[model samples]
Every structure is written in C-alpha cells, then in structure tokens.
Target: MSNEPDRAWWKEASVYQVYPRSFNDSDGDGIGDLQGIRNRVDYFDELGVDVVWLCPVYDSPNVDMGYDIRDYRSVMDEMGTMGDWEGLLDDVHDRGMKLVMDLVVNHTSDEHEWFQQSRDPDGEKDDWYIWREGDPDEPPNNWISLFGGPAWTYDEGREAWYLHLFDEKQPDLNWENPDVREAIYDMMNFWLEKGIDGFRMDAISCISKPHGLPDADTGEDWFDMDLYFNGPRIHEFMQEMAAETYENYDVMLIGETPGADPEEAKKYYDDGVDMVVHFDHMDVTYGPGGKWSPDYVGMETLASAGDDALDEMLNTMDLADLQEAIRYWDEGVGDEWNCLYMGSHDQTRAVSRFGDAHDYHRESATLVATFLLTQRATPFLYQGDEIGMTNADWDREDIRDVEARGQVDILMEEHDVPYETIAPFVRNRSRDNARTPMQWDDSEHAGFTDGDPWIQVNDDYERINAERAMADPDSIFHYYRRLLDLRSESEVLVYGDTEYVLPDETYPNVWAHRRTLGDEAVLVVLNWQDEPRDVSGVEGVESPVLFGNYEQRDGTTLQPYEARICDLG
Candidate 1:
C-alpha cells in the first residue's frame, strides 16, 4: 500500500482527470480500462494528484463517450470488468486518494434495458423515458440538441419520437415521475455504498424537459432548455441526491448545466451540494455577447457587462484572467460556483486547445499550470496534462465522435458537399481529438497498452511522452509537480484571496495578477509576445526573483511566452 493519506485527504489536495479512452490502456483493446489506470497508479502517486476524476466508465453504447450511460452499476466491457474497477478503487484508497466518476443520469443509452423496455410496443417500463409524437406536419419540438440537431428522434418501431438533448441515441429521463427520481437517487447510494468518494454529474439539470411539447416557429431558439434546464424540481432532486450521498460522506458533486443561472446555481450549493460549475465563464471574452476573440476585448464591450460583473467574474475565475477562465478546465468547479475543468469525456484536450506546439507550448503550459494550481477553488489536473499533451491531427474519416461524425455525414450526403468544405469547422467541433490515447513512453501505442487504442495518440507523442518530460527539470511535468508541491504546502497560494492586476495598459499581451494572503501578495506575470517588453506593473520588484520562465533582472525585458512570479509583503 502507498504511504499516502486517506481519501478524506483531498480537501487539501489537487485532482488529476483521467479520461479512460485517452488515459493509458492496460489491455490495448482500442480503449483505456481500469487496469490501464492501475498500471500507472505509482506515477499518479508520485505526481501527487489527490483525486482521479475518471470520465464515465459505465456500460454504454459509446454515443456520447460514456456520458450516455446504459448500466449505472457496471463498467463497460470494452474498458474492463466490474472486478477490475473494484481493484482500481482499492488501489486509489491504498494511495490515500479519492476517485470521482462521471454521473451521466440526465440521459441513458437507447440500448439500456429501461429505455429498450420503455420503447417496447407492449412493455412494462413504458413512460420511463420521454416519448412524444411528431408535429402535425413538421417536427416534434422546437428544442435543438447540444450536438446541433432536433432533440427529438422518431423511433419507427415504437411509432413515437423520443427526447434526446444530445445525440439521438441518448434519451432523456422523465424526472417528473416519483419512481424515476427515487431510482436516480438510489443509484447515488449504490455508488456511495461501493466506497466511491464523489460524482461529476452530467447534464444533471436536464432530468426534466419542458412540460408542454411546444413546436417551432414558436420564436424561441431553445424552448426546452430555457424551460427546463434548472427546472422547477431540480433543486428538490438535488437536495434528495445530496442528502442521500454527498452531505454525509464529504463527497464532491458537480453538475453540468450549460446555461444555469447564477442564482439557481447558488441553490445547488445551498442545498448542501458540494459545487456548481460557473458556465458564464466561457461567455466573458467580450462579456455580454460571449464571443471568443483572441485579441483582448475592446473597452466598449468589456465595459458593457459593468465593472461589478467583471469584478465578480475575475475574482471567481478558475484559471488565469480571461484565458484561464475560458481555458484550463481540468481544475473543475464545485458547489458555491466553484469551477471544474478536468476534460470530462466530452471536452477537447486542454493542451491542444490552449497550447500550441510551434508557439510557446511549454511556457504557456507552465503558465497555465501555475495559474490553475494556485486558484480559488479545488483544481483538477487532466490525465495527460501533466506532460502537456497536444491533440491528434484529425480528418473527417478518422473522426469518431458520434454526433460530430454523424453531422459531417449528414451534411456531406444530403447537400452533396465536399467533406473538405467543412473539415476545419468539423475539426474544431469533433470530440475525438480529445479522446485519443495517452502518450506514456516512446513505444508502440505510446506504452498505453499492447493492443490498439480506441483513438490514435497525437503523432508527435514520440518526443513528448511522460518519460521524456519527467527527466527534464524545466519540462511541463516538473513544472506541474512543483506547482502541486507549492499549492500543497503554501497557504498564500493555496488558500489565499486572489486579485487581478491589469495588463500594462499600453501593452496588449502582457498579463499580470496577484494572490494575497494577509499582507503578503504573490504576483504572476506572463509576457505573451515575441519581443521583450517592459515589466512596469506591480510597484515593487523584489531583488531575488522568486520563479521566472526566462532570466530576470532590474528593468528586465520579457521574451515571448515568458512568465514570472514574485512574492511581496
């Protein structure tokens, strides 16, 4: 057994996300499994991530990775067996770490026994899933799926259209039924009884859809979500779920609701839920409008959201100013508007999305690491992010995300358009790029497993594997390790209050900030430019540099992608 503390130990520790498909694969059956994770337990223990937020590992049809659960009680056969999961859990506890699994109860697989029976023409479980009728002459409802299509899918055999907020394969559950809500809560107890420490709820608020099945030309872009996302009974259900598991066990629970209102979010935390993700975060680049502009926001739009809104946003941010708030999600959110960022099964890889290979990938990775590890909430580290992994090059033919691939096919076949025409847009939209295999060591399949992986590893894995990064002190791995150590040991960075220092008003690329505990403040600066610039922010520049990416001196010039941190009274 490892000498780590007990699972309760994570309150003071950091988490590392492990997306099964991309995490190391022990058996190499084209997917990552429990044994694959177990094989690297020692590495995790060494890196010192207190919790492992495993992406969905349940039995599923792989429609939305594991977000579309078929059997809440078991692991997918492709990933491993129930026994394998048990063993992995034991290993985690032995190392004094906790494991957080994805709780995808908002929807279930089309093949799930419940859904199958519900859709059966003459079955016992009818009405378990939301089944509706098509429009008199057009479609079912005006609601659009997150994957970009009608939320209702007609089942020919059943003569009814089932509701799916995501892929057609995932049918949303009807939480209005007492038995349904009870059963959902029962699943929480089931996992808790198994000694599971926590859950990352998937689309938990979508448990109930709009009461009335209103059709489109109805004027509203999305009638379902606006009407039901943080539904009337969502808080009630959350309270029941929390009372059953979270409140008593010191469990961490986070729900995934895209448009959840802040006031509504406070309900989850207030009802004894551990945390709720701050989704409005990704919306602040231009503020009010939520556009993703690389160039810093102009004063006009930035001012529109008001200084108060921006102040609260910057203060509650899970990462660096705007970018960290938008990027670096492995450090996910919790109750009380705490942010969660581990790339659950659905999101793209942090490295590829935020780090560019030709650009300051390593520097930016380190800067990002420093930013997230020392933030206000509990930070989560995604599986391969310790080594700064990048996304694999994608092709439409190589795409595997069900919704993305299906959409591409529909567009191509229906419109007779070239795949190349929408390839770039599709590439940005595909989830498969984030689902590739973990890059472990330089070997076949990057030492993930003996067999093929579910997704291909980034082609450059040969040079950017765990073994290589770990060997270099200046590497992303070492930098992350240092951050973990500092955050674990220092109160100022770990438990201190955060304040944002504006950029050198004149310079567009220089980002700076500070974290203060009592009178002591720690300043972090990043110069995202090719030519060196003046370090004019933060009045006092301590004599001895605390930590810097590039060498620093009085009136030091910052190089492109350079970052520096200073401690002051």
Candidate 2:
C-alpha cells in the first residue's frame, strides 16, 4: 500500500501459471500458443496476479509436454513463430506483469542436435552426454532411470549405454563438462537478454547430479544417490549460474524439487536461490489415515484435521520447519521465499485431493488459501484454482501425464488388479488430474476453446467456470481476488511472523494463525469443516473484518467454511 515499492517484489506479487499448450490457441491448431499467453497478459494484470510462470514453449519433441528440450533458444513450432515469441514478451511486459520461462537442463530429447552428435562415438561432441560401455550380458551398472526401468539406454551405433534419468529418448546432459554449463548459462542469458523477466526451474534441484554414478540401496538394477537430490557442488554451480545468467537482471527462481529429504531440501534456497516448490509440509496432508483408508469412512464423524490431525501430523513433522526452510535461506544466503497453493500441472487440483470438492469445498479451499497466503513466502496461484476447480471425474484412459500412466500401469500389472481398482488410484495420483484445461465458462470446452482440447475438461465446468465465480461475491474467485488485493495492500500478510493457536471450545473446525509485524497484527481464521463455528482471538481494540467469504457482524456466528481476516485488537 505504500508509495515506496518493491523491498521484495516477488514476495509481494501473486503468480499465475500459463500451461502454454492449453492456455489459448490462436491458430486453430487445438493447442495453445505463446500468442495465447500474449492475449491473456492483460487478463493477468487485471486479475492481480503480478507474476506469470509460463510452462515450456521451447522447441522440443513434446515427449513430456515441453520438458524434453531440443533447442533452448527457439520457441516450439507448435507454440508459434519466433516473431510470436518476441511479440509475446513485449505484451507481457507492456501489461506490467513479469514473465517466467521453464528451465529444463537435466535432459534433452534424442532429436536434439547435440544428443544426435553425442551418440556418434567418433564425433567431437561425444562427451556432451553420459555414455559408458556395458558388459555383454549385463547392463551399464545397476542404475534405473527415475522414469521407470534402467537409466542407461544402449545406443545402436555407439554400442554403449547413455545415462537418462527420465525417458530413454531424453539423455541427461553431463553438466561436469564446462561447455555444457556455459551453454546453459548462455541460453538463460539469451532469454533474459530478450527481455524475459526470469525462469521457473524444472527439476532444477536435479541439475547437479553426483558425478560418480552411484547405485540405489534398493538392491535393484537402479542407481539413485542421496547425493543426486542435492549434490555436493549444487550450491556452487547454482551461484555460478546466478552470477553469470541471472545476477544483473531482476529474475526470480522458483524451483521444483520433488520428494526431497528435509536436509537436501533446504539447499534449494542456499546460494541466493529464491523460492523452492517444496513438499515437506504438503506431505502432511496425505493419507496414512485419510479418507481413502478403509477405516476412515467407517468412523462415524471424523475429527477435524485442524485439531486431532494437526497434533498427529505436526507432532513428528515440525510446524516451524517450514519457517526454518525459508529462514535457512535468509540467514545463510540472502533470498526470498516463493509462496504457493495446492495445485499445479504436476499436482492434483486442491479441491480434489485435500477435501471433498463437491460439498465442503468452500471451507477446504479457504483453509488452504489462508495457510498459503498468510505464510511468510511469496504466493503462486494455479490456473482455475481461484474458482475452486476440482479434478475431472475419476477414471484411467482419460489420464494424460506420461509418468503417471506408465507408473500406474506397472502398479496395476504387479497387483493383478482389474481396471476398476486401478482407475481410481490413477485418477487420484495422476498429474493429468490437474492439467485439464482452464475452466473459463459454462460453454462447450468450458470457454477455453472453440475446437477440441488435447485433454478432457472437467464435466462440472458448466457450474465451476470463471464466469459464474466472478459474478458471485461469495465465489472462491472473489475470495481469492480479495486475498490478492489484501496481499497487495498489506505487508503483514506478506512478511509477518506467524503465531499458531490451538483450537478450543469456540471454533471447532477453525485453524487460526496470527501474523504480526511490530505493533500491527493480522488474524487469518479459516473454517476447515462443513459445520458452523465461533472463535475468540479478536480480543483487542476496535476490530474490523478486513476480508471474508461471508459478511459477519463483530460477533456473528461463522458458517461452515467461512474465511475472515480480522484486524487485531
């Protein structure tokens, strides 16, 4: 709210993700293009999402969306002409919103010119990829690719196995090679120089793989090192990258380090790496005894996760560790936190996984929002999440994520299960559960497209689209807009010290966290259940309801799933 701007712009700003292939299609090609993103830059500016994290539109074979990089410099042939990319950058900046690109340096598609040449044993660029000879009957070490089977794939021409942490076609780059690192930094600098703001690093934490190819302890033909997740020299290399590629420019690094151990996880923000898409806290929300557990539905009425579950989940897992993750970065190397919500292209929709999206969605969504926005980091809002988007109707053939499809098939085959038993599991676990096109309207294709979509749109789009939410004051979209507005206007929500309160007699389903900045205190209270509740923490001076899904009198009873930000007394 102050006239003075940007002590930490990324921290204060709201980020909206653009999955380019599905965002909006301009050429009637069924896939969304960069121009589609260009068309929506103004929409983002008006919607109050200050940052735009664009999913890869880079030239690729489209094996894993756009993650399999073929050429880092060229825009995808499907996305648009290079002229469209230039115009797209101009449009984003003209709207006063920041643009972020996906940095996927772990591997490149087989078709990439580098990989093609690297496969030739006699070629000068042969050392660019990790390739080694295999014993006649055996394989090249006992290393399995993170994707599924063996990490090393035999190349017919070279008669040697090449390291590929993912799909065999996308060979891992040997970053130890100075030329490779220089190429990556130069590619980043190329984009940064092209007026792009920054990047959202894909599998960034996996960049510094342990040089000595190590084997997994699982006693299988697989190699996975504790070091691979967070290698010894990662910080050094990343800092070097920041200095060479992103140092001079105003860029934000949002890292996605999946399934990282707590120790290695903190390394993300070390060396001034900005915000990390960490999942330590998120794992707490999973079901060792959640609804899917056979015992859960049988239990008459479940105890609120706010009370019983909080104590159980947080007892072993540190509530303060989240703050610790961010603080470790602040104290060690100076950098900010990246705030986030429950959904991404890789994550299931918040409503689908966290709570019953059908009935108690308001309460569940508000509880998650309060937790995400009120925390000390910067916040990124997934597309259609503001309107409380849920997963597509649960099924198997409908799935889209390549990883989930292959893994689920393997799981089902091992269990000797019928498709019925496996379908729901895949539905719950698949990334495609989140990648369904943005729910824009109640029209055919949810107003996302006039043509057929690459992925199925959620059936409830008629009821859950943006048009309906934007019109209704109580809609989740309106609540998010209000929250984004409040975040834009208040420093307390952005960087305040948090104080959690144990729920007691008054509000049974509420999870309250007090955020304080010196004398100013902000109380964000969320109703996490489908029942009415009352709370008693606002015991100070003339209190005002700063924001809420429902309009409540000073002492009015809060309905199920109500959310409110009240001024501290």
Candidate 3:
C-alpha cells in the first residue's frame, strides 16, 4: 500500500489575488465592482489559475480600503449589489475556478450596527467590542496603534475607550465574547452556503488578545505586538471557528500571520487553517526597528537624505535572508501545505522590489514567475504581476495609501521628522505601489475606465498593458501562462520535496534548488541579479533545459536575470 499523504485540492491549486477597487472598473465610476470582476472572468480562465482570491468588497467606509467592515452580509454599494456578487461567484465557478473571499473579522468599521448598538453601555451588545473605562485624557494602556497614534480612542457617548489596532475608525472586536464569535461564524456560514470556496482571513493572528490587554514594557516606540499577537487563546478560537464553520464545508482556510516563524506557523494548521500566509520572506528587509525605520530604506540616518538616496541605496531584500526564510518554511511545514508568493495587495510590485525592473524588466519578471511556480507550494500570483507591472512613481502629493499617510503623520507629529526626508522611502515601499489600476490596454486611463480612476495608473501603462503583452509571445504574460500550464501538468513540481543548492555565501545572487519526487528531479536555477553568472559548477546544470526565460541556452553562463528548469532523469 502507498504511504503517500492524502491529496487535497487546495494543496495543488494556484491562487490569483484580485484587488477589487483596481482590478477592472465596469461602471466607469473609476472603482472596480463585482460586475467588473465578472467581465474579466475569462481572464482568470485564460491564465489557468485554479483559485481567485477576492479582496474584501463588503460594506465599508473605505477607511483602510475595506479592511474595516461595516456590514458582513451586505455588499458595498460601490462594489455593486448582492446580485452582482452572486453573478461573479457563478462566473468563476463556471470556469472551473474557485473563489475565496477576504475575511476581515478582526475589526469592524465604527459605523457597524454592532458597534453602534454597543455604544449604549446598558445594551446587550455593549461588550461586542473591546471597550474599557478610563480617564478621558489617559488611555487604559500605552499601546500604540500599528497605523499611528495611541491604540485607544475615546468614545464620548459611552464615556469609555475603545481599542483600534489599525485606523481609529476600525474598532477591534471582542473575540473573548462568545456572542461575537457566534456572529462571525454565522457570517462565514452565510458565505459558504452561497457556494463560495474558502476564505483568506485578514489579521487572523490578531483575533485573540492577551488577558488584561497590558501596556508595553518595551519602550515607547512599538506596536506592542508581543502583547496582542499570537495571544493565549488563539488556538482555541481558531479551532472553534473552524469546527463551527469551515469544517462543515469542503473549504480551505488561509490565515495572514505577520510575525509568526515556522514553528508558530505550524500551530495554525492545527488550529484548522489549511495554510498560512507567512511573512518570513516578505519582511526580510524590514529593519530591527520595523518597516518605517531608516535602515529599511538603506539609510543609516535621515540627516543624509537627498534626491539620489534611492540610487545610493545600501539595504534591499537580501538573497540569503529570503533563502533562509523560504527554506525554513518549506522544511518546517513537513507534510502540510504552503502558500508561496512574492507580491500582494499590501506589498510593492515583485519585479521592482526583488528584480531589476529598470535593467532586465522582462527577464526579471519572468524569472520571478519561474521562482514562484516551480516551488513546492501553492503559488499566489498578484493582479497585474503576470503583465510585468512595475511600481508606481508617486510623489509626496500623490500618496493614497492610508498606511503610508499614517506613518508619515506619526513621524512628523511625534518625532518632528521632515516630509522631504521620508518621501523617497515612502514612495518606494508604499502599499499604493500595488494598488494601481490594472492596465488592460494602451488607451486612455490604460483602458481601466472611461471616467477618472480611483488611483493613478502607473505611467508606463502604454508599454506594459495586457493587450500589448498578449500580442507578444515573449512577453511576461505569456510566460506566466506557460508556467501555469506546466505546473498543472506536473505532479512532481507540486508534490516534490525541495533541496537548496549553491550556498548563499558562495553564490549570493543565484538561487539554485532541486525539487525531487522519488527518482524524478527538476533543477531550478535562477540568476537573481542583472549580470551574467558562471553556473556550470552547480549540480545537474548540464541536464536538459525543460524551460527557461532566455531564447539562447548557455551551458556554462546564465544571462542576467535568467531562469531555467532542468529535467534530471
């Protein structure tokens, strides 16, 4: 009898994340709606993606861009009605693709009915949110919000303080309250019953809070993550939630865990999450002081900030750090599954961040695609990434992301930091870089809308739109489609065990790895930098080149930003 682990659909699936506001604008209102998604259903099919992970389109105040949910069951008016969402779900299903909704139950908009009712201190829903009694001037604790300012907000009507880990308008739910958990489960079931595939739970690790909600013991500059993250009853809450909702249906549950390491990530699987979106690889460049620190932007001090700071950068995503993180999770998960990604709605463009966008745009983007698809995990391709989208060139006045604005506000208000000093770093690392409208064509507004767009389209749309890419066989879009097709046909690539080769110290700019399944092995060689490298010394480097980004095959030297998948039988 075979001892191989049981096969699951999610383990073998590849996901495509769609940011609704920027995916496609159908109403010409400049914002993408459900109908717009329905219009592009054929695109998902053409790309051969197995799952479409839709970002939150629920009723929201647009604070934090729909992360703060006002109504769980109602679809936002701008995104269209419930009928539009149902049509989208059906369209996706008809194409043999699954649809996963973004679950943002960690917090709700202050305008939520539950929060509104909770304001009446004597009401039954008073404890629905994390409310505490304290002096008006001083909060119950000294916890700092992840966005900016104190974590607590004064509620004049209730004469109490409420906790908001993100924007002040987004109040954290009291998961400790059984009633709150029940309500969330009911909401999940409602969506599941409607035939949706699964959920991508947002800020899921922050669902449970530590007892007493203590203040920070570690200095003043901190989000107090240690106090609130991976809380005491996190496992219990997750297990309960799963048993009550997802376990009843054939659905997958993926969690967004920010600070979790490999061992910590394993617990989520036990807590009923099929897999977790780990930050090990993503947060590699974030300094010890966190994302906004000067070290993250390659600056030792803001005093030396100048117009050429970006060109004189010292810090960037380290290959060694990325390798270590990827290898750790790849091995740490054991027989369990993993979610592989290099870009997301909250991150900068993959080609710009990890590849040489200015020098080897096509080579680097296709190389990055090769890296993700050839891994031993279910890969998630972010919207526009397949078309080799680059980050936006936003100036200080063009910044639209709330996270960037909040960080800027904090730095200026508390530390008296000048806007000019932080503008370059913000422009490079802002989430808005990934939120730009999808470039469908080279027409006006890049064919995204007839009216004004919600966010500015990347200025390079004329050269990098999908229409141009599809017409070219050698474009990044076609490369992605080929990789997806190859991945679907090869079980070895999906179920193979990974082995890292060429130690980071010896080959710092090259990523050489082997995926082996029984006697079949595929060697994936990636030249991560924009310079030719001698890869002849690597094991199995002479094997048959099953696939590669370059037209000419070099047995000894790998071209700049080149990638190859070699079959070694």
- In terms of TM-score, the best-performing candidate is 3
lDDT of 2 by residue, 419-525 (tens): 55444445555677677878778988887777888888888889888788888878777777778888888878777766665344454455666778767787777
How much is 105 displaced in model 3, in angstroms? Answer: 1.0
lDDT value for candidate 2?
0.70
Judging by lDDT, tell me the better candidate of 1 and 3: 3
- Which tens-of-lDDT digit does each residue in 456-551 have in candidate 1? 677888888998998888889888787788777766665555665545356566666666776666877766544577765445444345676555
Residue pairs with backbone atoms closer than 3 Å in model 3 (clashes): none
User: Where's the lowest-lDDT run of ten residues in candidate 1?
Assistant: 286-295
Span of ten consecutive residues with least summed lDDT in model 3: 306-315
Task: Report the lDDT tens digits of candidate 3 across residue range 258-328.
Answer: 76777888899888889899887877766676677664454335556653446235236678888898899
Clashes of 1: 21
The global C-alpha lDDT for each of the candidates, from Candidate 1 onward, is 0.67, 0.70, 0.87
RMSD (Cα, Å) for all candidates, in order, is 7.2, 5.2, 2.0
User: TM-score for each prediction?
Assistant: 0.86, 0.87, 0.96
Error of 1 at 389 (Å): 1.2
